[model samples]
Target: MSLTANLMKTGDAKDGAGSEFLAFTLGSEEYGIDILKVQEIRGYEAVTRIANAPEFIKGVINLRGIIIPVVDMRIKFNLGTPTYDQFTVVIILNIGGRIMGMVVDSVSDVTTLSPDQIKPAPEMGSAFNSDYMIGLGTIDERMLILVDIDKLMSSGEMGLIDKMAA
Candidate 1:
């Protein structure tokens, strides 16, 4: 069967095989994650600091009885200094049965992109890993760095969730 026909069977298919991404801002660049993985978006909140954890792992928050680790994207992406203001928000994600929160500069709109609008991320050196990159998506004049949220969360650096299997 063709890609369009396969997408139509899924029921949520858009004009010819398209995917939805939740776009957010980090510094001057915009990034997107699979919409299905996002649980909710909330204003940045205080988290209980964890001792000896990586600086990127800001801390944990009690999210309706369940504690969830919150990661700062600025630190993870090596985006220099980060500042929190009225626009800062935390994106709660449910990836591979694990729940966590990602702190971003601001939340943008959800964008739908067809296959024609996506391009593979070019291979960078060891200092830059593109393992979690889905591709670069174009919407009008805007370019979004698409991310694979599941792989990012399960990466060895974010060890809390993966530690459970050990």
Candidate 2:
């Protein structure tokens, strides 16, 4: 099965549950992830840098004795280097049973989106592709770029963190 087919299945499942999104800001654009995947949100803290890791991997952090790999979403999305400030937040997510943290500019609010309100991601030509985007969620006049966290951090990619731990 292709990634698009898998995403279509996911979209079908989501259509029945009436999903909620945890919205956040990356620069001026708004992004969201399934609220069910979010574990917690914490203020940004300095991370212990890991040697020989990918550039997008910001390093690891000790969260309640668990070592979680942190990825800077701003850089991962090719937005730019993030500026640490009051609005900075680390969104802890449980993806495929692995806990990882993602740094974002700031968290907005959780909003509910019915299946009818969600639209397929637009085809955009760029280095950062839209495959990771599950759909486009709209509430009122705001748009949320809903992300598929599992696709964003696939098993193969997560294996790197496990390897580092070993």
Candidate 3:
């Protein structure tokens, strides 16, 4: 079964355990986002470029007749030069009724973390703003930088800087 199907099948399998997150890699670091926001996962492909769009905004792609904008998390977060390989994939997301795509490295798996396993993101200076972080999730010896996809996608930095300044 597909990841989406797996998600639907186990929607409430861990009802009282905690929330689930879809783990994906950007560069060397691993990140996780709320699984509920993901629509589907697709392999990376060439996209139709838009005139004068930001470098971070790779382009757009047609998904079942719907055109959605694609954003490269590596470029957006300044992680490193992004490389497209067999493992690279686009994670289609539905944010506030608007559909979009995020390109990332290989996806690992769905992780269910209890409340006790989540730790607050420490407030500090870094390349990535803490505002976009939900927190840090710990499972075994691995750690996931939980991302608040909704906030990050709709934040002031994402084309809202001008509007917010007014």
The best candidate in terms of TM-score: 3
Query: Which segments of model 3 are wrong by more than 4 Å?
Result: 160-166
Per-prediction TM-score: 0.86, 0.86, 0.91
Q: Candidate 3 residues 104-147, lDDT tens each? A: 98898888989999999999697899999999999999999999
RMSD of each: 6.6, 7.9, 3.4
* Candidate 3 backbone collisions, by pair: none
Candidate 2 structure quality by residue, lDDT tens digits, 30-71: 998987788778899999989998777889999999998998
Kindly report the root-mean-square deviation of model 2 from the true structure over all alpha carbons. 7.9
Q: Which of the numbered candidates is closest to the native, going by highest lDDT?
A: 3
Off by over 4 Å in 2: 1-17, 155-158
Error of 1 at 165 (Å): 13
After TM-score superposition, what is the CA distance of residue 135 in candidate 2 from its true location, in Å? 1.2
Which scores better on lDDT, 1 or 2?
A: 2
User: Of the pair 1 and 2, which is ahead by TM-score?
Assistant: 1
Backbone clash count, each prediction separately: 0, 0, 0
Better of 2 and 3 by TM-score: 3
